[model samples]
Target: MSEKPVVRSSILPIPKSIGLVWLNIALALILAAIGLGVGFAQSGLAAQQVILYTVLMAATVFVLLNYVAVVFEARAEARAVASEEDQEAESSRLRQLWADNRVLAIAMATLLVLYLILTAAIPEFRSIKNLIGFLVLELILLFAFKISGYFAAGRSAFIGLIVLFALIVISAFSIEGFLSGPNIKAILLFAAFLGIASVGQTMVALLGGLDLSIPFVIGSSNIALLFLITLGVPSYVAFGFILVLGGIVGFLNGVMSYRLQGQALIVTLGTGFAVAGFTQIMTSIGSQFAGNVFGTVPGWLSNLAAMNGRFFGIPFPPTIFIWLAIAVILIVGLKTTTWGRNLYALGGNRRSARLIGISEFKYWVGCYVISGVFAALAGSLLLGWSGGAFIGVGDPYLFTTLAAVVIGGTSLLGGNGGYGFTVIGVLVLQVLTSFLLGIGLEYEWQQFIFGLLILPMVALYGRSPHIRATV
Candidate 1:
């Protein structure tokens, strides 16, 4: 008797680009139809119009999310050595888990329907401004995701770039007015703040030094500047004073690290803790506003924070340009200037640098000073943006700044990174955080996500040639 052989069927669905492309195309058409319908009618939010908008948002979310899922799924597979069955099992679980994308899509759709029918919908929902914003945003994401497939991993920043775009696309669908001019600008502004702080971090990383006290320095500088302003110092002068204060802190860090030699981490950490404790004391005793200290910082300072002005058609503060300028200066100065070249060499190998007459000690002081000054500058800018600073204002930035530098592909051992990489990392973290918020994740959840993410990124770089954590 001949027994029929049983064939094992794979459980996981394979990655199919054609299907994702079709899904994106269909979503695009739906969004277009919704925009056209809204465009054709200049009037109220009727039941039919609400349904259309709701569907548009949901479909947009579905496509954007699925696009990201497929990309990640493909990445996982490429990185995997698992058996076909295991891949299938994981794929199946992902399918089940992410099906909530559709469910949540429907849920948001339903919520929109009910909200529009019951309450008065805001006029902003029907505006062409929103339509154009969304269209432009989606188009960019779709294109970026498409382009990302062409690049090799670790060879470029394309992965982080597209991942950011996909997240923003989903945010546009999930968070109302997320794609609008104001929200996007707000994200950029925050990114700029991180960029400012990252400048110091980048330099320190370049010199194979770490500044753990950055958070407190930034927070304290912010409060100190406000304290100065209230004491009748000019805003510009107050700002300068904080920068000087930051330099002092950085100088202290350098002196300690230099004296101890290879103890930059411990020195910076101790200083950071000390500064943080003092800042807390100051916050408790300083002028109060709504249960928190409100420095009487001047108006124009706030204007920079608020990005009150714009060039041509662009929004104000122009923080991106500021970040770009900082990066450019760092690159060129490091390339063209003797100090910059020495700094890189010093970072690359201290013994060799000293042996070659690079003046390692002087470079160390300058590097730390630069780091401190930038930290203070970042703090002051943030204070202006937020109306004032609090005790923990710079706390989150400590980790975020390090994560940004590392993610930007800057080597932990130093002498092998750029501001461009830091900027990309800054944008990635900012966009990810923003998207998580848009999806209604709480603060704790956001922190959890950062923790989960930062480890992997560090681990990825930690194995590279320049990683010398013990050193």
Candidate 2:
């Protein structure tokens, strides 16, 4: 008798595409409900309550429906792939389509509809300028998501952008009460400086190195420049000297890191201490020099502590130009140069980079050098902004730069980031600090709140499945 043919079966769990989609929708709804409750409790417009509630409910339903539709379609395709005898062809086609444009199209459509409704229903948001600003911001965010592959990879970035947009809108309105023209200009200038300084730090961190010396470098340079200015050095000459000094310090950090071939953190920290000591010595020397001159220097240099100056009705103070220049140079260097690509390669995988004949030492030095230059630039900007720098001009930036770089989504483990993210990260941090100041929070409280806000974003950005797999 012929033996009965045996049949075997394998179990494979279907991807939870539907489940994920529903979960996101549910979370969004919960948030919407909470927002509605808060608005109802706080809003004093009795006449407009019905309209407000109706608009809120409509928005909730619309978002929920849109999410459900997209998810259902994706799930259906997934199911079809699972059931197919030759799954490869069907799955590949679906993935290709998904990757090309379906998700982006859906997202853009949703945002457009939401904006239209918000503008129509909320008179305050209907102003042409504000509407245009909103559109521009959304487009930028969309482009960011597209380039980063965040839209395709997972839902986290999509959610993040949405949350960020909400925060930006709130800030645009709420900031008016607290920010005078001068105050706004000051905040923007500071943010720009912080942005440029953090670029170098971010590049360093991207290469699996950290420079603790940045703050000291900046502080020393600023103090030196202040001393020069007090000695009647022309503004142009003093500025040129400050830039050179910053470059020298940066080059030194690079040399030290390259020669040592050890933990960058410890190396930079030691350098930082030495630099700090030098700064103190320089400050003392400057004070003595001024004393000996018997008050020949202009008193205005001492009295004008605030960097409060106007530029073309913008109130940009002197420091803004320095910050803008630094930003421009960094952006160009990183985005359009061979050195930038090599730096990324070295950071991503040093061994592979070596195999490919990339000079690890040279790129590593370059990273530190860049960091140094930015640090010095930051110092100079600080001095100019303050009208004259003090010994501690660079103190706050040490931690702030690190936080900004990490929060901007630059991998602390090295590789995988850009200056644009750094810019946003700086903005986010500055905005948080400004918000705290606006709310009249004490300095300590502001620091605490800022930390609280940043830590989550950093942790989220740093944790990665591929890195975990490697470990």
Candidate 3:
């Protein structure tokens, strides 16, 4: 047979590094223009703040997107070539330069523009106080971003030290006695509480399951604790009981999910409804029984309920203790324990896990149990923070927790996430919420904005494009 000559096809040329850089610059300009246009339409100090925030966020997103695109594009090109050594070298050079320079350059440019706008809009902004405030704000961002990057780049142990340093710096810069120490402490306490709550959801997500029941579970537990408190139970005893109850609920979820062999979403949703109903009933019971046991309730319990008590010269609520305890326990459990390893294994590949002699059912049960305990702890904290549980106490947490977990970079699809990401995710979401409120957005608008923020993160990190491609 006559041999035919082989012909290589090269119709679509791979995009060059310069081309990608130009594209990124173009995107940044478009983002900047849109942000300024929005600000101009709004017409006030609020508008300027919004514009600055928008520019920062847009620029950050642009950098991240471009980084991902460059990495993936290089990989794709490498796969097509006879030899990828030169291509990889070129890609690496481009990536290193961009990472080292682009983000900072954009940040500096945006800050300069914001400074001009602030000076123009508010003449008072030129004062020393305003300048100091801007410097403080910049420092906070620098610390936060540096810490995030440090841990995200795989340096885990340094995270705590970085956070501690950041906190110390923030406290040092604070207007001493400007706000009562107790009030400040309470705010920090609540922030920690919400952060831990988000961590629970993140853990579940890491295992490749979404527990929609988290809200209801939390609400029910909170309501239960409130009922116990109203019935004259000591706070510590109530806390213990709530924790046990949460564990039981989690066990049930694990059992049901494993036995039914159903979708985690469907299973959790069903449980959530059931738990929510139970919570409403519990709330009604607590409200009715409050007066009957007022005399029996201990003075210490009542004092603890207020969340303004002083502990070791630094005023903090009991909820803060709960948050700290939960954070420590969960973080350690996930990182060090065999059960945690199993959850990750199961999440990554259930079939492979089984082949390795890992019990999918047992680990699944354990995950639910852990989730339940954490949710319960969150519920108890909510009760203490609120002075008493109210209806829908857990409702907001459901979405927020999921958002925090997803935002923190925990994959929604099973595996490839951690508690650290959840913590950062929680902080980011809370700050964003606070910022939105400060800007005077309506409640509905806040929810809408959060959803918008959360969707992108979830879409980017949660789904596994590589896995799908391989499949």
- Local accuracy by lDDT, each model: 0.70, 0.64, 0.63
Q: Per-residue lDDT for 263 in model 1?
A: 92
Q: lDDT tens string, model 3, 1-471?
A: 212223222332323577776777788778667556545554444765866776886778577656665566766655566346665766799899877655444554555556556555543344333344446645654554455454544432233333334334443343343235654564566567677667656766766777787777787876677677767777688878888888888888888878877577888889888877766664566357421112233344434434665455555565566566766877788779987888777777778889999998777777788788878877766665565555567778877787777666667777666887676666556545554454455787667656754543343221334222343
At residue 66, give the lDDT of candidate 1. Answer: 60
Estimate, for each residue in 1-471, the C-alpha lDDT of model 2 and write its tens digit. 222222222232222466765665676666456445445544454637744764676566656555555556665655554645446665698889877765555555655665565455544444434445556755655555455455444333343454355446555665565346666675776787787678678888778788888888887777776667667888568767777766676677778777887667788888888877876675576355321112222333322223555454553454566566666776687768987777777778888888999998777877777787778767766654565456567788889988776666666778756666666677777766776576455687567556655544453332344332363
Give the C-alpha miss distance for residue 275 in model 1, angstroms. Answer: 3.2
Model 3 steric clash total: 1
Q: Is candidate 2 or candidate 3 better by TM-score?
A: 2
lDDT comparison, 2 vs 3, better candidate: 2
lDDT of 3 at 422: 73
Best by lDDT: 1
**Number of backbone-clashing residue pairs for each candidate, in the order shown:** 2, 1, 1
Worst 10 residues of 2 by lDDT: 290-299
Model 2 spans with C-alpha error above 4 angstroms: 1-164, 173-183, 232-234, 286-325, 462-471
Worst 10 residues of 1 by lDDT: 1-10
CA error at residue 202 for candidate 1, angstroms: 1.2
RMSD of 1: 11.1
lDDT per residue (tens digit) for residues 1-471 in model 1: 222222222333323566765666677666666665665565556757766776777666565656565666656555365667766876898898766344333433443443343223434345554455444544553454345446534423664565466566656665678887777787888898998898888888888888888888888877778776776888888788779889989999999998997899999999978876666576557444421456566777776676674544566675556666887888688878988888777777788788988887788888889889999988888887788666568888988999898877777677777677788889889987887576565687568656755553343232235523334
lDDT of 2: 0.64
TM-score of each: 0.64, 0.62, 0.60
